[model samples]
Target: MDLANYKNAYLTFALSIQQTRVVSMAAGGALESFPKNLPRAHKDYVVDASAKMSEKLKPVMKGVSGSSFEMEFDLDDGNPYLLPLVGILFTHVAGLGGSPNVDYGGLLKAQEVVMLFAHLEAFLADSIRVICLKEPRVLKKNKKMQWDTILECGSWEGVIDKMVDEYVFEAGWGSIKDKIRNMRSAYGLEIGVSDTVLNALDAAEQLRNVLVHNGGRVSREYLERTGRNDVRVGDMVPLDGSYIEKLSATVTVLGGDVFSAIAVKFFGARPDELRLVFKGAGTVLE
Candidate 1:
């Protein structure tokens, strides 16, 4: 009855519902506007690629945690699912072939980066559900709820938020999800990752790039009247500290989600085993 009973958990549930709706709407819109003039191959490829990638990544990409570790992503797979990442990248490259500032090189790279993060985010969320359900924390924190309850004290929302926060602090993907979420919302759709997820993904991606690419860093001097250099960059930036923090965060977030979803969907063994499968959302709550 109290508003506090809902709070953060309710917000997260609402956001999840909203995001699902937005994705559905976006897909519907895209389908509606499909040019009749386009070749059948284009549509076939999109459907085939999305389905294959979704299936392939669904199994292995679980619990990515948005980490910056290159080794974490170094899978040698000939799965058909991976074609979409390459396909999406090629589209942008072809479209923006001219001009240096907004040209093919930068645009293609950006497309890959965006697609990679999108795939990573979904994988992380799915992983959290799997891990948490399979290996849940003993529910000592809230004695009111039964230990057997899948989501203790109805605290799945808090669990998700905590995981996301940890992932953000650790990964460092540069708030790209936030930017994309905001952009989508502005256009009247509510698609987004949580702020916690966004932060972790950004940090992870950024730190990973710095480590793998041997990218150079330059210090730009902003002169005040007194000309005192604040937060100056030293000779060589140690990538170790930043990357470890990000990877740790990623683990927690993805792990938590896997736990929660599994608890919700598969707690107490398969629904048939517990005779609770029919007690789904279709039933009215007392």
Candidate 2:
């Protein structure tokens, strides 16, 4: 892969997430004053519409009394006025009846961390696939396939693609150490990341797993994988903005490291040349 491709992809992901965070913060601030910011006419319309909707729903509510089904509203109720009314209701609901003690910012940050690692995993798998495509001999026949499946591919390129997908799927994207070892063993390619970067990546993977599978609570597996002793299992992992920002920066560095290694090893690119290319593309390599 070209260094610029990797740089652009990662930068785009990071920038898009940062913009989302900014927009979310702005929306939260706007929502605080959403009711007050409406015109008098709009306010009156919202009040009248809400009362009318409540009356309309009263019959349905009585019909479903003591049942498990919750009330649902169609936001696109064909009335344009309902949109602003929905926004007003959302403000109160999200604020938990005006107290507003919910940690929405933390929740967003946690989700961002999960998404960042997911992107990294996808990029890593793509890198492996690209390398196997470029050098087909590097793909070991470790998977068994039926003759029908092989024939179904129809072409050599299709077969190779199937083999690549199988390899990536079986190899999985769990342990960073196992990933590095697999890359070196299967493709004779060394990832060449520092211990610090490897540890960060490992910790990131662990955090992603906990956030996804354990409701962001620390697990024994997380501690074992990340080598973290700071928090015990069952504790909620703190995903503050600064911590997520630092993790994002580390992930970006890890991306560059992996991309540079792959480019040099498989694409016949020199490190110095790749650095210059990335710099020309506005990514400073250290």
Best-matching candidate per lDDT:
2
Which ten contiguous residues of candidate 2 have the minimum total lDDT? 277-286
Error of 1 at 19 (Å): 33
Per-prediction TM-score: 0.22, 0.67
In candidate 2, the residue pairs with backbone N, CA or C atoms under 3 Å apart (3 or more residues apart, or in different chains) clash, namely none
Write down the TM-score for model 1: 0.22
Give me candidate 2's TM-score against the actual structure: 0.67
Q: Evaluate residue 87 in candidate 2 and report its C-alpha lDDT on the 0 to 100 scale.
A: 60
Candidate 1 runs further than 4 Å off: 1-122, 125-197, 214-235, 240-246, 258-286
What local distance difference test score does each model get?
0.38, 0.65
Best by TM-score: 2
List, residue by residue over 1-286, the lDDT tens digit for candidate 2.
4555655654564465456556645544543454445567766666666775676557755774345433466666555667655565556544446632445556677777777676667767767766766777777666588999989999987888889888777666557557876777777775655666566667777788899999999999888877878899999998756666666666655565666677778777765655532212222112
How far residue 193's Cα lies from its native spot in candidate 2, in Å, is 2.1
